[model samples]
Target: MTATAPVTPDMLTIPRKDTGGGLPNLVGMTRDAMRDALIAAGTPEKQAKMRVGQIWQWIYHWGVRDFEQMTNLAKDYRAMLAETFVVAVPEVVTRQVSEDGTRKYLVRIAGGHEVEIVYIPETDRGTLCVSSQVGCTLTCSFCHTGTQKLVRNLTAAEIIGQVMVARDDLGEWPEPGTRTEADRTRLLSNIVLMGMGEPLYNFESVRDAMKIAMDPHGIQLSRRRITLSTSGVVPEIARTAEEIGCQLAISFHATTDEVRDKLVPINKRWPLADLLDALRSYPKVSNSERITFEYVMLDGVNDSDEDAHRLVKLIDGIPAKINLIPFNEWPGAPYKRSSNNRIRKFADIVHNAGYSSPVRRPRGEDIMAACGQLKSETERGRKSKAQIAAETGT
Candidate 1:
């Protein structure tokens, strides 16, 4: 769907039932939605709003799951809430930690479908890469996750659950009445919607989950620290700026439409020129200083100096930072990583053009948790030896 195209009421409705066995997950719902849900669950109308605030803090701010831990609420009221609702996140099927300290989680959501969430811990900060869909719709040639077919859009619970899951693994949640806020540093500080699926394709769930992440009383991540990356879904660009108001990143892998159409197939729909126009206007709409243009460097495809110059021209007016990602190769992938010299030359061209061009260091390569390799390898390992051989024609 184009970024600007009106999402029909039907399109906004995710097909899965939010309430399970008569108990709804309160993790994803907005404040207003939660308040209404409480009233619907036989809560007194006068107390619903107050109850939502309490429950919201207990679940999000304090990371409390059991209603018994909601000590501020009365015993009977806590029992009533426990009987009527659930606070759930995706279950971690397996977690792999790379040699460089990047942690990749294979998380199972509703319906047994799984997605990947990666946490990269740095000295000063940490970034979590979260998925919006179970698999993916677009087949970006360089992305490993694109090989899998789209399963379904993740619910807001599943989406925000990624953050919670990573926090659980990292032990980053604040403990009550302990050290001051100044004594702590968040291990999962930044979030990027750059995993498994193209986020804009699953817009509403992503937006709502991000809102939960940004809420001051919950995850409390600043809007600046969250980035929503798209493969040039033009119509939704403006809406993303107006509604989501987070940082934006484009999967601008190629300089020209001909090359881009092959690298990012979504370019065939929105194309480079049209995408640039939307990007140029993004800063004013989102009130963000700069947009990130992610250029994956592949050998002999679109990494030429000419392509670099063309890229500079393409994004001339917009405030942008160019991320030069050396292609992270996966099994059966068609491309090779650009040579170090070639990447430096390309970076030099963009740097000379006055854009901050940083070559993204490959992280979590040992565990297949770098830029694109996030399909559950454990699932692939489940195939019989004969089945694997047959698929490979070996």
Candidate 2:
């Protein structure tokens, strides 16, 4: 799709890629899908379900990438699996470590299209920001990823494979048979779908991948530990809660529809009122399961005291936390980060309104891995200015 073409709301209505190519990579399939895959590969129907469990545990729980390492299966069966299927994730093209312990990976997938995955280490937990698409579909004015045109949505394998790739990097996997209940809280403890595309735009893949992420026999992350951030794709918001059941975060930068329309262009499709209405009835939102409102503090634009008060009033009844992100500026970004004092004032307004407002510290800025800075650094000149403007309307 060219950049300037107007995107239909349901344009990403097809499957991500040709999954039927070669041996299907078993990384992102649901248990039912995998069971069917095994049965189709000539496994006896009675043995398929049992075999699926075994292989699932091997790949996800133990991080085994090779069928040869699956010693429980017979040698013949192992050979069969190897010939008929491949366990694949995105390959890390380059890894950059920040001074503050964040690791950014440039991973190349099926078409040699690369996306960035970031792992940020904190005192209590380490969170990995995984991408859903090669480039974003939405043109959020302040985001660097919005500068690129949408290539294609990532397959389920490429989606969840991000976690596996990071696990490989952190050496977070356990010995095959030695995994325990405690392994769920490892260094790569939490996952945020805050990296690249509008995840809800690629709903099915994100849902299936997150289902695998929360599978007990695999990565085993708790539902609460996973947060899927969306750029306010209203219709899919409820579906996200039902299918994914992860924590929800909104890219809620501006308070009014007028400002939000310019900041997050998706707001034009699903305006702030509609987005807020969805949030108010979000399936599981509560005091504990509060939704996160990710507000990027752009200098002199959305950082005024009036904007802060308006934000609190806008999200009044929703059980929520305001994540005040100091805008992470890119080379051609139109906005600058708000002053520290302005950010503090904005935080104060929300905090006084009985919401938990935490100013998110800019992490991995040196590596361009901070919030809103995650576009594929690959494929720069491939997209012309007209194409980008067509896609993003910058």
Candidate 3:
């Protein structure tokens, strides 16, 4: 009898690279799909159910990049899993630590593209700002990442991996084999999908990653603690509340459509009226969990006292708070940060109007990890190469 070739598993999966088109298939299978995969792989129904639990625990709780690390499983079973599935994380190309104790990482996704993840350490809380896409689709004139054209939506693995990587850096893993509420809470206190891309534009992947993030058997982050920021992707706002059920933040940088159109180009598409209409009807949003409107103050742009009044009127009757972010300038950004006096005046107007408006101090600016300052060095290199080609007429 001829000897059968050894049934070795192929386990060389890595982050998907951008291809200027649709995103790569980087294991976006849902939890149900994973269960089906386990059952189909000859694991008995009961064992398959048990195995899915085991795998999910290892993947999320431990951040294991390989199936072999699941030492509790039979060796052959681990090989079977390796042959079929992959648990991958984006490659860390560059990492920076700011003097203020902030951390920023440039993660390489597939297709030679990259995105940024930032960790801001505060006195009482640590927040990890995670990305949803490779670059961004919205060309918000003020945002550094927005200047780069959208490549593709990041896979669920890529999105969740960011939190895992941050936890690894923070050394906050649960004691090896088990997890408790106290242990998990001590790991990463909060997550905000406020990084390189527009979360609403990449809704499906963002939703999947969030489901995994909130899964009781996995990351177990509370819905109240998670916030999804969008630049008024109006059509999807209600669905985000109904499906994802996380806190909502609108990137409402300007009070009027005329100014908003120039700053956030997507405003021409959604406009303020439609965005507010959706917000008014958003399900489960209440005064206790008010929507957050993020206003980036640009000097002599949207920081006038009159502008703040228009903002208060615009968001009238909506239970919301405002976060006035002083623009954090990147090298080639066209706008300047608002003056301290202007920012304070803007906040005062909104605050006196009986709504909570906080002026956000720019964080991680030294590391290029602050608000609107998250383009990767790899993307900057690519732009330089293109400029050289144009200059040399090659």
lDDT of 1 by residue, 26-48 (tens): 98898889999989988899999
Computed on alpha carbons, the lDDT of every model, listed in order, comes to 0.83, 0.87, 0.80
1-394 in candidate 3: lDDT tens per residue? Answer: 1111111221122344332234222234567877887787777887877888888888777666567888989999998777766666677766677766677888887777788898877755788999998778888889988777777888887888788778767766665566355543353678999998999988988998888888887778889889999998988998998889999999999988999999988999999999899999989678998999999999888889999999999999899999989899876677888889888888898999999998888877877889898876576577776763542234
lDDT of 2: 0.87
Model 3 lDDT, full chain set:
0.80
Order candidates by TM-score, high to low: 2, 1, 3
The candidate that achieves the highest TM-score relative to the unseen native structure = 2
Instruction: Report the poorest 10 consecutive residues by lDDT, candidate 2.
Output: 1-10
Model 3 TM-score on a 0 to 1 scale? 0.89
Model 3, total clashes: 5
Looking at candidate 3, what is the lDDT of residue 282?
A: 88
Sorted by lDDT (best first), the order is 2, 1, 3
- In candidate 1, the residue pairs with backbone N, CA or C atoms under 3 Å apart (3 or more residues apart, or in different chains) clash, namely 2-235, 2-236, 3-235, 3-236, 4-235, 4-236
Give Cα distance to truth, residue 280, candidate 3, Å. Answer: 0.7
